[model samples]
Target: MSRLTVNKTYKLYIGGKFPRTESGRYYELKGKKGNLLANVSHGSRKDFRNAVVAARKSFRGWWEANAYLRGQILYRIAEILEGRAEQFEDELRAQGSTPAAARKEVLKAIDLFVHYAGWSDKFQALFSSVNPVASPHFNFSVPEPTGVVAAVAPERSGLLGLSSVIAPIIVGGNSGVVLASQSRPLCSVTLAEVINSSDLPGGVVNILTGMRDELLPHLSSHMDVNALLLCSDDPAEQKLVQGEAVENVKRVRLHPDAPLDESPYHILDFQEIKTTWHPVGV
Candidate 1:
């Protein structure tokens, strides 16, 4: 008698829970050599909207959480990822990465988390400024999270590119609804599992596996989403996002070529500067 192989089902992660797409749609994930790798949920506009709702619902709590606590959670995510390094390497290899490249990407993704963790509580202070004025007044500006964010993760270098775009957004307290790479989505789903055990609040970072071409416009035009992060090299996609973003004027950030970066600016890119003034008695 032969044993039956049970396949693992990859679903969308919303509110820290895994659920199949509401539309009951699915797509086949094929490897570089035309082997069936896995089945990923083909997320729909309704699915993205549901994730956005979850994100908005969880935003206040996550935004008001202790900065140090947020940093701790991010570091914890990295710790969990490190423990699952082999798993990620295997996923990367399944997604067409060479052994050495998979190892490097997994390592880089882990370090990227820690890098943003260190900046979590510090970027605000660095971006803040005390304004100079001749009048009897105290004036200053500080950075604040931009509420719910939506992103189209890079189409290539799935693990590392996904990490590079998301760590910066969430480290600063913004909740995100990100669309993972269409072809190389295995690592993205696996990372969602890592996040679930890393002390992160539900809905803080939702991951959806689907076609970026179909989701980019919805991510842009959605009024609830306060910002958009894009990592594709497609000029048409970029133009579509920018055009749709005018509906609510979401802060849009695009990285056409290899969106990998350790800079704090990426964190600030999703933030807004709030200035205040107070009268100082002479």
Candidate 2:
């Protein structure tokens, strides 16, 4: 007699809880050798809408959190990732990454989180400006979270790319709805578990695994989403996203390729600069 193994049922991570797609449909994920990797939820427009609602609802709490506290929460996520290093590496391998590459990517993802963690409390200083005005008034500009962001995670590298895109957005106090790597999505859900356990507030980061073609329109056209982050090189697809975004005049940031390094500029991509004027003397 052979022992039975219980396979994992992967679901969409929304508002800090895992739920099957409202469509109740799933697509089989396969490894390099065509072996069944897992069954991933086939997210639909409803799921994306739900995620946007969650992100919007949680925006104020995350935005009001102190910078230092946000930094600490980001660091805590990195710490959790470190503890789950082996599991991530194994999942990467299952997704067809060579053992060496898998290990390297896992480490890179962890370091990326740490890099953004350090930036959480520091980016404002670098980007904000106090103007030298001639009048009896003080003028200054500060960065504020852009609110709900909809992102399509990089399709090439599952864990590393997803981490790179997500870290900057949330660290800057903006909530996000991310469509994970369609083909290799295991690590995205796994990271959601790490986020759920961290001090970060729920609904701050929602992860959905589904086909890009099916979800892009909803993400780009949503009226409530303040911005859009696309990680693709397809001109047609880019054009489509941009065209749809015009409906709400949503800010669109396109990253044709994964960023070379975890730069603070990525955080600014989803930030809105607000200027204020104050009387210098009473």
Candidate 3:
């Protein structure tokens, strides 16, 4: 393949338009052989704050949209993935994955979408249970979106890990800000293109590629972030992030490494439990 002509411009994806990073910072993605794959922008705290605000503002509509509609949108993303499989695979390979493994990762990502799409309607029933309580009232519990979430995808397995982290949250009706994998950032930025082309909402899932250690502290402490999912391989660091989340009492999920076939329960980790009671008699 020929070299990617280094471009002179880039745009931040905020409020659906690709504008330059507010801080006017740009960084390069260096391949294992020290070649440049692409230039990704480093998001400032202000940019991160702006994205969070956008996500929070968009949360109500996304969480309230009919589950079927969300499912349809997710299904459309699957179609888009299929159409862009080669591009995604090329990105995977560009990020140090073997060609064969890149192909597998791309397929795995699509499979994840299909899996979540199937769950869009079914998970509600499975998670919601009619409680047999010791009260004279009809009682039951259901899961609801936890509002805006902040996520750090795994450092390796770029595309696959990204899809895994993203599918579950949005499928459950939550909006999120994702700190893309630092080692393999190109694919995550490219995913923004895929999302813009798919049926996903404007701010449902925002992707930012930057220095993880620098950005994660901000995400962990942000009160607007209702929940946080850290998918790093460093157990100690994961523990520290979980600790920071306790200040705001924000829900925290720590995974050193979740398998490719991780169960639906892990996806439910970022959700909130909501219960309702109604009288059956006057």
Candidate 4:
């Protein structure tokens, strides 16, 4: 008798656990050759709303965590990812990346995490400034986490693009809810597993897999989400996000068809500047 293979059912990573979509709807994920790969939960607006609530609940803890500790936690995520390197590479290959491309993306994702980990403790100093005041007071500005961020992960490169968008946002202590690539979402789910095993707290980063059109409107318009990071090429979608963001005056960062790069500016995108004044003679 031959043993039958059992396929895995992918679910949404919300709060801390993996739960099937509330709608109980799933979409078939097929490989490049049109073979069934897996059944991915087709996340709904309700799911995105749930994710935002989770992110909001956890924001203060993650935001107040010591900068060095945040860096350590991010580094731990990189360690966990490094251990699962082979698994990620395999998933990327299954998603249609050539073997070399898969390996490259996996390595790049790991390195990107480490890069942000290194920046976690350093960004504040680099971005902060002291202002000369005439009122006999010391005035200075510092960057603070913008609470909750909703990001649309790049649709092209599964692992690398997702990592690029996420690592920087959380490195500065902002918790995030990300919409994974609809066509290639395996790495995002796997990354959620890696995050779960790592020291990063639950709700610090929530991963949802589904259609962008289905999720974007809800994510962009949600009042609880403090910022939006979009990685897309669609002008219509970009316009829609900008228009909806007006409801909350949300900070919107649009990367229209742009390749991901290593920069501290990405971290700044989700940060709010706060200035403090101290009486000099008090």
Candidate 5:
């Protein structure tokens, strides 16, 4: 009898090619059974910038998309994700999740997708408000897409946390540069495939795996980035990212370092600012 061998390395998702990391830095990933899954490429600043350019190019069309259309696309993504729940669970298990926990995470992830999917149409109503400031002309406020955002997925609940942060921003019509969870990034890369297959235009959400300390600073301070979401629980680093966010006044979210459970209204936390302009005169 002959023994069979299989290749199991992952690729860097850039320019639509799953090429190996440009910097050639690779890291070992342990699986649910404590077995080595494969080596994941560690993205660098150059790679991050490349992803940013892709996002910026894709932003105009995505942002200009009608709210209902965007909602439909996002909802479609949720539908696809639900249909492919097993695939995500398999990836999660490869990242070291038990079957029960993987199922729970997949369900939450679907809910997270649907949650943000709904917001694609509703966030505008929730965040956009009419102001009666007794002004000379019809004055009101509206929330606009904040252009490109940079995100860091929570280190722990790697898959679900990444989805929670990324979905809201993109559904709201903003493009993003996301740093995948360093320890367990397989799910993030797989998510890129999900978005690619969905109605979402290219670059709506770009995922990169790399050292947080190395890549986050550039993302935070990058003048092109309009906002950021720090999903990690490290107060020191969180504070630093927030501080850098101030330079660009990037919107920031500091998620709690809690158990891998659903947080209430988590999607709302990152939705777009929608302000409606209307006349105060009756």
Candidate 6:
């Protein structure tokens, strides 16, 4: 008798737990050579809805957490990701990256976390300002997190791209529900595992795997999601999301066309500017 290889079917990461899709549907994942790789959960509208609820529930705590503490949590995630570098490299290789590229991507992903960790407490100061006023009132303007952003991770790069987008979201004190790359879903679930072990609060970041077209409508139309971050070139799809977002007065940011890069502006992309006026005494 011949021994059989057990194929593992990965599930969606929601509210800090891995659960099979409520619809119990899955798509066949193929490797670079066109062989069957694994079964990735085909997440449904219900799953996206549940993720938003979880994100909303955890918002205030993450929002109010001191910046230093948030930076530490992000650093901890980098630690875990660094320890599992070889595993991420393997996943990247299977998903069509060359050995050298795989190694570089793994390193980049780790560095991305650390880079954003350093910025966690600093961006606010660089971006916030006090304005001179002619009146007796002093004016101050600051950027603050927009709660519950739902994003479609870029389709081209897997772990590197996913990390590029996610690090800034949580570091800025915003909770997120992100849909992973449809073509390369393996590393995302693995990242969820790393996040789970890194002392991040449950629901602070949610990752789901599914068809982008299938999930975009729900992510856009949901009333509870405060912002939408999308990476798509299709004009029709972009129009659809923009139209739907108007119903809830949601912020819609179409991700830039360039490859994933680290910048403090990316973090500010998810933030809203708040202005305050205070009376001054002579």
lDDT of 5: 0.76
Give stretches of model 2 more than 4 Å off: none
Cα lDDT tens digits, model 4, 20-104, are: 8898899999998899888999999999989988999999999999999999988998999999999999999999999998998
lDDT of each: 0.91, 0.93, 0.81, 0.91, 0.76, 0.91
Backbone clashes for every candidate come to: 0, 0, 1, 0, 9, 0
lDDT of 1 at 271: 90
> Residues 1-282, candidate 6, lDDT per residue (tens digit)?
899987666889999899999999999999867898789999999999899989999999999999999999999999999999998998899999999999999998999999999999999999999999999998999999999999888888889888987998899999999999999899999999999999899999999999999999999999999998887777888899999999999999887533358899988988999999999978
TM-score of each: 0.97, 0.98, 0.93, 0.98, 0.88, 0.96
The predicted structure with the larger TM-score, 2 or 6, is 2
- Model 3: per-residue Cα lDDT at residue 278: 84
Instruction: Return whichever of 5 and 6 wins on TM-score.
Output: 6
Deviation in angstroms for 28 in model 4?
0.8
Clashing pairs in 2: none
Give the runs in model 5 whose Cα sits over 4 Å from its true position: 1-8, 15-17, 32-34, 258-282
Q: Please write out the lDDT profile of model 2 over residues 2-108, one tens digit for every residue.
A: 99998888999999899999999999998887889999999999999999999999999999999999999999999999999999999999998999999999999
Q: Model 3 has how many clashing residue pairs?
A: 1
Which candidate number would show the highest lDDT if scored against the true structure?
Answer: 2
Among all windows of 10 consecutive residues in model 3, the one with the lowest summed lDDT is 8-17
lDDT of candidate 3 over 1-282, digit per residue (tens): 899875634345665556667888878888879998777788787888988998998899998999888888888787888898998888788778899999998888888888888788778888888999788989989998899998888887688888888888888999989888777776776677777777677988888877888888889989999999888778677877888898899998876654245366855786777899988897
Q: Which regions in candidate 4 have their CA more than 4 angstroms from the true location? A: none
**By summed lDDT, which 10 consecutive residues of candidate 4 come out lowest?**
254-263
